[model samples]
Target chain A: MKLTILGCYAATPRSFTNPTSQVLEVKNHLFLIDCGEGTQMQLRRNKIKFSKIRHIFISHLHGDHFYGLVGLISTFRLLNREKELHVYGPKGIKEIITLQLKLANSWTNFPLLFHELNSKEPQLLFEDSAVMVKTIPLKHRIYTNGFLFQEKPGERKLLINEAVKYNIDVSLYNSLKKGKDVVSEDGELIENHLVTADPPPPKSYAFCSDTVFDPDIVPQIKHVNALYHESTFLESEMDLAFPTKHSTAKQAATIAKLASVKKLILGHYSTRYTDINLFRQEAETIFPNVDLADDGAEIIVE
Target chain B: MKLTILGCYAATPRSFTNPTSQVLEVKNHLFLIDCGEGTQMQLRRNKIKFSKIRHIFISHLHGDHFYGLVGLISTFRLLNREKELHVYGPKGIKEIITLQLKLANSWTNFPLLFHELNSKEPQLLFEDSAVMVKTIPLKHRIYTNGFLFQEKPGERKLLINEAVKYNIDVSLYNSLKKGKDVVSEDGELIENHLVTADPPPPKSYAFCSDTVFDPDIVPQIKHVNALYHESTFLESEMDLAFPTKHSTAKQAATIAKLASVKKLILGHYSTRYTDINLFRQEAETIFPNVDLADDGAEIIVE
Candidate 1:
């Protein structure tokens, strides 16, 4: 699994920095998260194929989080896209996008789908044979949700030599990989474990941003392979962070330590802080594994 | 009058090229016109003072023309703006803007006033002691209007040396500047023309974009000091231009020639064309005075 950060700044986008937006690639799926303004340009700058984005997950209704959405939808229609696009966001997201399309009198020719979400509890958002996605309800000034992406456990690996030693027929290899006991040609039952080995462990990523220091989410995202949490301010600015319902670097590190995530990626930095390394230094005091997310930075999940 | 081209390219914004948006400074007032995506960053790149912009004029509801507006508005609130902002655009603009603000629950602390226009004929949009703005109806795929920013004729300049030579009292200089004949302290009648000269001819600029080669605007924008016209295609692509309701370079020059504009500025070039100079060459064939608008190019109206 790999993740690309298109933008990681807080508040407004500036000439040198952008707002929140990123792309997560897992199991051949590219999922776009929090399309802030200038995301399409950032996508182009990073050479990411626009066609690869089939699903977009929005965390909230803040302009910095989802303002680029309508423009992207319009560009898709302009480019003659025919594939259906799915959007998962807050409840009012559909109304906001449809209103702009209606006013411009430029409706999409392709099928546009919107999955409005306003639930306060964790709920499954999407699931397929290879992967599954669910919400991690977050505490913010507004109704918000972070998404959890996980790769489903795969079928057991077939041990070809062991299967042959067990006198298993080639046609029954599929059943053996399915962890089922198979009857040999001589009417002898062969245990599936004798002919197959365990597959590689699956990986998971949890995305949580624009939220306060709420421990409620720690249990939901516990022990994820990677966790991206918002660090909008430093511990020195704790006074500003709480009233604004944002998290400081120390608070984010505390959450990371409590959840026991393999790695913590810090992002959504307030532009006022000139030195981002200060966050990493502060976070490392509590959490040993900390990574700072910069625009265009990519992380490979291990 | 000074005009800064923040972005002039047509269609979607790319890493190098931007969509429609510009900054016009006339009579000490800064006005933002057609805020496409990334406009705020463009404004910062251009070193424009955000507080000076009290008015924004949108040509149409197309994504490329006004997608950046809401973000700019939201940024104003985040920056703690206290001044009132007036936005003039098509009829549905209010609903489009208000809906997003409502959904985000980020109403601006400053007053935001919207002026919706649906007139088929010319209408006055704004006026002050120094400048006046009006709408120029244009034929496009949607209800669109071009803006005419004209500096109201100023009070006649008081020629200080001439005024002293005419023996005009200091107290009467204001009257002399107002084009009033004044009685000198020596009991001599001084004609206003003898002491004062006409102020620099009131300069005017017409912004016409995202429209086809419609001649109906010729009479309205006739003889303006500078006219910025959309040239989205070349003469070779006239077929596409007409179908898409856009104009070619040659067609834009034809309108400029017909309107007898003092100078013609061509912009909104289609990004498909690598050579923008071709637009200038084609336009120069029809009009003697032509200027090509680049993303950061600035023009001074003389």
Candidate 2:
């Protein structure tokens, strides 16, 4: 699993900093989260393949989160894309997009499916054999949601050298790799554990942004391989955190400490502060494994 | 008169090139036409005083034509702007924007007025003492209209040096500038032509884009100071122009020639071609005073 940060600034799009958006690659799927203005350009800058994006998850209806969505969709149609796109967002996205396409008289040749999310509780938005995505309820000024990407359990690996020395039949290798006991020709029961070794551990990532520090989300994102939380303000401006429903570096670190995540990545900074190292310093004071999320930064889960 | 091309590339937005958008400065008034994505950034790059922009005219509901409008409006509110913005666009723009704001529970502090154009026939949408913008009917996939921005006849100039040497009275100067003879305080009739000269001939700019080569609009934009028309295809690809409701470089020049326009500016080139000089050459074959539109390219009409 890997996460690529396309943009991380909060509020509005700027020349240097962008709004909220990212690409999360899990197993075989690429998920786009929270497309802001100039997001398509940012994606091109970061060398992201547009055709690989199959599923999109939006947090809320704020302009900073999803204003670039319509343009991206239109570009897809203009490129004569035939792949089907699945969109999951809050209510009103469907009407806003469909109405524009209808007014312009430019309908897509492909299929566009929208799943308007209006529920208040955590729910599963997408799931497949390799990965599953569940919504993590967040506290914001409006109806919002964060995504959790979890990888399914992988199959065990077989030790080829051990299997050859033990004279294991090639036809029974599949069953042996699945942790099954096989009966030999002499009616002797052979254990599969001796021939198979452990496979790599599956990793998961959680994305939480444009929200205040809510301790209740600890249980939902517990033990995630990586957690990306918004740090819109620094410790000096912590007073503005509660009123704006945003999180400061210290507050995000506190949540990271409470959740006990594997690693903490901070992003969605305010434009007032030019030096971003202050965020890492403030976060590292409480959470030692915290890192600042910069544009084009990639984090690998291993 | 000056024209600032913000984004003129056709189809979609890229990391460097942008989509269809421009700002025309005529008679000390800033009029924006067809705002696309990254337009606010383009305005910043061009050093345009965005606060002076009080009127925005959109040709159609295509995302590239008007996706940046909501972000621009939101930025105005953030800047604490007090000017009342008037937007003339196709129908459904108001509903799409207002509904998004409603869902986010954020409303603008300044006044935003909307003039939805759903009519098929040509009509006058806005007119002031210095400028008049009338819709020029065009053939397109959508209900698109071309905008003719003509500077109203300005006040006649007083030829300051000549008037001073002739000892013209201040009161008579004002009347002469209005093209009327007035009796001086010395009981002498001062002729308007003797004291004042005609003001620099009022100039005009006609913007027609996202449409095919429809001769019906030729008379509406005839003999303007300058014309910026869309050239989405090259002469070789004229076969594809009719199907897409777009025009080739030669076709656009044909209309410019028939209308007897002084200068023709070709833009909105298809993204398939990397070299844009061909478009200029193609149009110049028919119209000598032709130029290609590039990002941040300024055209001065004197």
Candidate 3:
């Protein structure tokens, strides 16, 4: 799995720093997350193919989180895109987008689907043979959700030499890979574990942002391979974070530590701070495996 | 009057080229015209003060023309702008803006006034002691209007030497500047023309865009100092221009010639043609005084 941060700053997009947006590539799916203003330009700058974005996930209704969505939809129409697009966002997302398109009198030529999520509990959003996506409810000023993407475990590996030694027929290879015992040609039973090896463990990624320090979500995102959490303010501004329902670096680190995530990625830094390294330093005090999310930075999950 | 082209391309904003947006500064008023996507970045890049903008004029409801407006409004709120903002656009603009704000639950602290324009004829949109703005109806696929900004005539410059020779009292200088013949203290009538010259001809700028080859608006923008007309296609694509309700360079120049404007500025070029010089060449064929509108290019009305 690969993750690319198109923008990570907070509130508004600056000339150099963008707002919140990212691209996650997992299991043949390119998912766009939190398309803030200027996200289309950021996508182009990052060299991400526009046509590859089949699904979009908006965490909340904040302007900095989803303002670029309508523009992207319009651009798709202008580019004559024909592929169906799916958008998973808050309840009012469909209304906002439809109103703009109605006013402009330019509707999409392709199918535009909306999945309005308003569940308070973790709910499955999408599932396929290769991957599954679920929502992690978060505490914020508004109704928001974090998405968890998990790759499904593959079939067990086949040991051809062990299967041949057991005199197992080649036609039984599929059964062995499915972790089933195969009957030998001499009517003897062979255990599947003796012929096949276990597959590698599946990896998962969790995206959480624009939320306060909430331990309630820890159970939902536990043991994810990588976690992206918003650190809108520093520890010095903890008081401000409470009122705004945003998280500080230390708060995000605490959550990561509680969830026991393999790696913690911090972003959504307030524009007031000129130095971003402070966030990493503060997060490392509690969680050693912490990385700062920067625009165009790519991370690979092993 | 100063005109700054923040962006002047047709349709979607590219990595390098922006969409349609500009700043017209007249009589101490900074008016934003057609704020396309990524206009705020352009404003920052051009060093244009955000606070100086009080009025925004949107020609139409096309995404490329007004998609950046809500983002700018949100940014203003984030910046804690206390000044009132006025937006002029098509009838459905208020609903579109209010819906987004309602969805985000972020209402502006300052007043946001909307002037919805649905008239099919010329109408006054804004006016003050120093400047006047009126809408010029245009022919397009959607309801559209081009704005004509005219500077009111300023006080005539006083010829101090001539005033002294005429023995005009200093207290009556203000009256003379208003083009009134002053009565001297000795009961002598002082001629205003002999002591003062007529104020420099009031400069006007007409912005007509996203329109087809229609001569009906010529009289409304006639004799303006500068005319910015959309030339989305070249003469080679005249066939395509008609159906799209867009104009070719030659058609824009034809309108400029009919209107007898001092200079013609051609913009809103389709991204298909890379050579922008071709637009100027084609426009200058019919109108000798033609200028091309490029991003960050500034024009002074003399």
Candidate 4:
């Protein structure tokens, strides 16, 4: 799994800093998360193909989180896109986009489907043969949700040399990979474990942002390969975090430690803080494996 | 009068090129004309004082013309603005903006007044003691209106040296500045023309964009100091201009020449053309005093 940070700042977008948005690539699917203003330009700046974005997920109704959505959709129509596009977001998202399209008299030629989300529980949002996505309900000033992307377990790896030693026919390799025993030509029974080794472990990534310090969500995102959490403030500004329903770097690190995530990626830094290294410093003090999220930064899940 | 081109390209915004937007500063009023997407950042990049912009004029409901408006308004609220903001646009603009604000539950703290226009004839949009704004009706794919900014004639020059030579009392100088004949202390009639020459001719700027080759607006913007007209295509693509309701560079020059504008500024170039100089070459063939509009290009009306 690979994730690209298109924008990581909070609130209004500035000349150098953008609001919240990112592109997550997992199992050959490119999912756009929280399209802030100027996201299309950011996508172009990063050289990400716009057609690769099939699904868009919005966390809330705030302007910083989803203001760029209508413009992007309009551009798709202008480009004469033919592929179907799916959007998942809060309940009012569909109305907001459709109204603007209606006003401009520029409806999309392609199938634009919207799945309005109002669930307060951890519900399965999307699933396919290779991957599954679930919503992690978050505590914020508004109705918000973070996403958890998990890759399904793969089939067992075939051991060709071991299969040859057992004199197993090539046609039976498929059954062996499925963890089934195959009879040999000399009337000897061969165990599947002797010919096939276990496949690599599955990996998952959890994205949490614009939320307060809520350990209750730790159970839902527990043991993920990587966790991206919002660090809008430093430890010194802890006093303002709860009032604004935002998380400090130390609070995000605490959640990562509790969930036992392999790595913690800190993002959504407040524009007030010029130096982002301060967030990593505060987060690392609580969780040793911490990385700062910057625009155009790509993190590969290991 | 000074005009700043925040964005000059047509249609969708790109990584390097922006859509249609400009700032016309007339008589101390910073009038924002057509706020396209990413305009707030453009304003910051141009070093414009956001607080000074009390009025915004949107040409049409097209996303490229007004998509950045809501975000800018929301940013004002975030900045805790206390001054009232006035927005003038097409009839449905108010509903489009109010709906989004309602959905987000983020009502502005400052008063936001909307002036919706659905007139086919030129109408007065705004006026003050020093300046007046009138709509320039244009033919397009949709209902659209360009703006005409006119500086009201100022008080006649005092001609202090001539006034003193005429033995005019210092207290009566105000009457002379107002072009009023003053009575000398010995009951002698002092001619107004002798003390003051005509105030500098009133300067006007007409902004016409996203319109077809319609000369009907020539009368409204006739003989203006500066005229900005959209030239979305070149003569080679003249066939596409009418169908798209846009003008060619040569067609825009024809309009400028017919209107007898002192200087013609061409903008809203199609993104397909990489070199903008071609537009100037094509326009200057018919109008010698033609200038090309670019992002951050400032043009002062003399």
Candidate 5:
């Protein structure tokens, strides 16, 4: 799995920095998160293929988080895209997009799908053969929900050499790979564990931003491979964080430490600070595995 | 009066080129026209103060035309703006903007006024002491309208020495400036032409884009100081331009030549061509005063 940070700065887009947006690549799937303005330009700069994007997850409807969505959708139609695109976001997104389409008098030729989340509790929002995404209910000023992307466990690998020595039927191998015990024609019992090896360990990632220093979400995102949380302020600006429903770097580290995530990626820094090294230093003081996100930077998950 | 081209290319935003957007500075007012994506960065690069912009005009709802508006509005709020902003565009703008504000739970502290246009006939949208803007209906796939900005005719200026020798009263001077014959206090008939000279001719600029070669709009913008029209293709691609509701370089010049405009600015070239000089050559073949629009280039009206 790999992750690319398109923009990490908070508040607004400037010539030097941009707002929140990123791309996560896992198992032949590219998932987009929080598409701020200029995200399409950032995608082109990083040489990411436009067609690889099939699913988009929006954390909230803040301009910095998902304002680029309508533009991206229009670009897709202008490019004559044929593949269907799926979008999972908060409720009222469909209405907003449709209204713009009405005024523009332009509609997409491809199928546009929307899955709106209006619940307050954590629920399964999306699932397929390779991946499943669950909502991680977060405490915020509005109806906001974080997403947890977990790689579903795959089929167990067959112990081919051992199965051949046992003279097992090739047709029975399919059932054995599914962790089921099979009976041979000679009335011999073959254990599933002995015939198959364990599959690769599942990896997961959770994205949460624009939330306060709430630990209630710890249980939902416990022990994941990587976690991206908003650190819009620093230790000095702790007073402003809570009132604005934002998080500081130290507060983000505290959550990362409690959740025991393998790696913590901190982003969404305020534009008031010219330099960002202080964010890394502040987050690393609490969480040793913390890394500051830079615009256009890529991180590999091995 | 001065005009700066932020982006003038035709199609989607490429890695290097951009789409339609510009800044018109007239009478100490900054008017943003068709804010495409990356306009914020372009503003920064051009050293334009954000506070000076009090008005924004969107020609259409196409993504390339006005996709950057929501982000720009959010940025203004983030920067703690206090000035009232007026946005003039087609209908449905209110829905898209309010949805973002509702989801973020943070609305602008300053007042935001909108003038949504859904009219088929030409109408006056905005007028002040110095400037007046009228709609110019154009033919496109969508309901699009171009803007014509004409400097209002000012009061005639009286030569101070010439009027003083004639013993003209201050109150009578007002009538002289208005180009009206006034009777002096001594009952002497005063000729308005002898007391004052004619004011400089009012300058005007017309912007017409994202339209086809209809030539019906010539009467609306005839004999203007400058006219900017979209030329999305060269003469070789004229066949495609008609079906797509775009214009070729020669077609744009045909309108300019028929209207006898002072100057003609051509823009909105398709991305298929790497060179832009061909457009200028094509337009100049028909019109003597023709120039191509490029990003960051400015035109100063003398």
Candidate 6:
């Protein structure tokens, strides 16, 4: 799985900095997460194709989180996109977008689908044979949700040499890969494990942003391959974090340590700071495997 | 009068080019015109203070024209602005912006006054001691209005040497600057023209965008010092201009000539063109003093 940070800044978009927006490429799916203002431009700057994005997940209705959504939707229409577009966000997102479209009188020619989410409990948002996406309910100033993307396990790998040595027929190779016992050409039963190796472990990534440091989300995001958490402030500004419903770098690292996530990526830095390395320095005190996210940065999930 | 082009391209905003948005600094007023996406960032890039912008004029409901208004408004609130903001646009603009603010629950602390307009004829929108703004109805796909920002005549320049030669009292200088004749202390009648020169000719700037090749607006914008007109297409693509309710460079030049505007500024070019100078080349065939607008280009209204 690969993740691209299109924009990671907090609050307002600046000339050189952007707000919250990213793209996760997993299992042949390109999921756009939290499109803020100037997201479309960031997507263009990152050289990401606009048409590949089929699903857009918005965490909340905050301007910094979803202001670019309507513009992106309108651009898709201008590009003559015909594929269905799915938007999953807080309950009022549909009304906010539809009203703008109504006023502009430029509705999309393609299928525009809106999935308004208001569930407080964790719920599955999307699923297919290859991937599953679930919501990690988050506590914020308003209704918000973080998304968890998990890749499904692949088919078991067949060991051709071991299968040949076991005298298993080639036609039964498919059954062996499915982890089922198959009859050999010599009429002997062959165990699936004897001829096939287990597939690589499935990768998972969790995106959490614009939320206060809450240990409650640790259980939901536990043991993920990669976790992206908002670190709007550092330890120096700890007093301003909770009241604003944002997380400090140390607080994000504490959650990462409690959840045992394999890797913790910190982002959503406030523009007030001149040096972003301070966040990494602060988060490293709690979690050793911490990575700082910047605009246009790309990460590979292990 | 100074005009800063924030984003002058037509249609969707791109990585380097922006949609329609510009800042006109006239008579101590920083007027934002046609705020598209990425406008606030552009304002920052141009080093224009957000608090100085008390008035915003939106040409239409097109996404490219006003998508950045809500974000700019929200950013104002974030900056703790207490000054009232006045928005002038079509009737539906208030609903479009208010709904988004409602959904985000981030209403502005400052007074946001919306002047919704639905007039087909030229109507005065704002008037102060220094400036007067009126609508120049434009023909587009939807209800749209261009704005004419006219600088009110300044106080007459009192020729100090001439006033002293006439033995006029210093206390009467204010009245002399107001173009009034005053009786000299020596009982001599001094003519206003003898002591004071006429105030500089009132400078006027008319902003016309996203409109077809309509001649109806010529009279309203006639003899303006500067005219910023949309030239979304050149003569080569003139076929696509009128059908899309846009004006070609030649068409804009023709209107400039018809209106007898002092200077013609060609902007809102379609992003498909590689060279924007072609717009000036085309417009110059019909009218001289044509300036091509780029993202950060600044023009002084002569």
TM-score of chain B of each: 0.98, 0.96, 0.98, 0.98, 0.94, 0.98
Candidate DockQ values, in order, are 0.83, 0.73, 0.74, 0.77, 0.62, 0.83
For residue A157, model 5's alpha carbon misses the true position, in angstroms, by 5.2
Q: In model 2, what is the error at residue A234, expressed in angstroms?
A: 1.3
**Candidate 3 chain B weakest ten by summed lDDT:** B183-192
- Whole-model lDDT values for every prediction: 0.93, 0.87, 0.93, 0.92, 0.86, 0.93
Better of 2 and 4 by TM-score: 4
lDDT of predicted model 6: 0.93
Candidate 1 i-RMS? 0.8
Fnat values, one per model, are 0.83, 0.72, 0.65, 0.63, 0.80, 0.74
Q: Per-prediction TM-score, chain A only? A: 0.96, 0.96, 0.96, 0.97, 0.93, 0.97
Off by over 4 Å in 6: A167-170
**lDDT (10s digit) by residue, model 1, range A1-46:** 8999999999999987999999999988899999999999999999
Greater DockQ among 3 and 5 belongs to: 3
Superposed model 1: Cα runs more than 4 Å off: A160-170, A181-190
Please write out the lDDT profile of model 6 over residues A38-128, one tens digit for every residue. Answer: 9999999999997999999999999999999999999999999999999999998999888889888779999999999999998898999
Model 4, span B129-237: residue lDDT tens: 8899999988888899999999999999988888878888989988887889998776789999988989999999999988999989889889999999999999999
iRMSD per model?
0.8, 1.2, 0.9, 0.9, 1.5, 0.8
Could you give candidate 1's per-residue lDDT for residues B246-295 as a string of tens digits? Answer: 99999999999999999999999988899999999999999999999999
- Evaluated at residue A274, the lDDT of candidate 4 is 86
The reply for model 2, stretches above 4 Å from the true place, is A184-188
TM-scores, in order shown? 0.97, 0.97, 0.97, 0.97, 0.90, 0.98
Give the higher-DockQ candidate: 2 or 4.
4
Write one digit per residue (lDDT tens) for candidate 3, span A152-225. 99889999898888899999999888899989988999988999999999999999998999999899889999
Better of 1 and 2 by TM-score: 1
lDDT of 6 by residue, B9-53 (tens): 988988888989999999889999999999999999989987899
Give me the chain B TM-score of candidate 1.
0.98
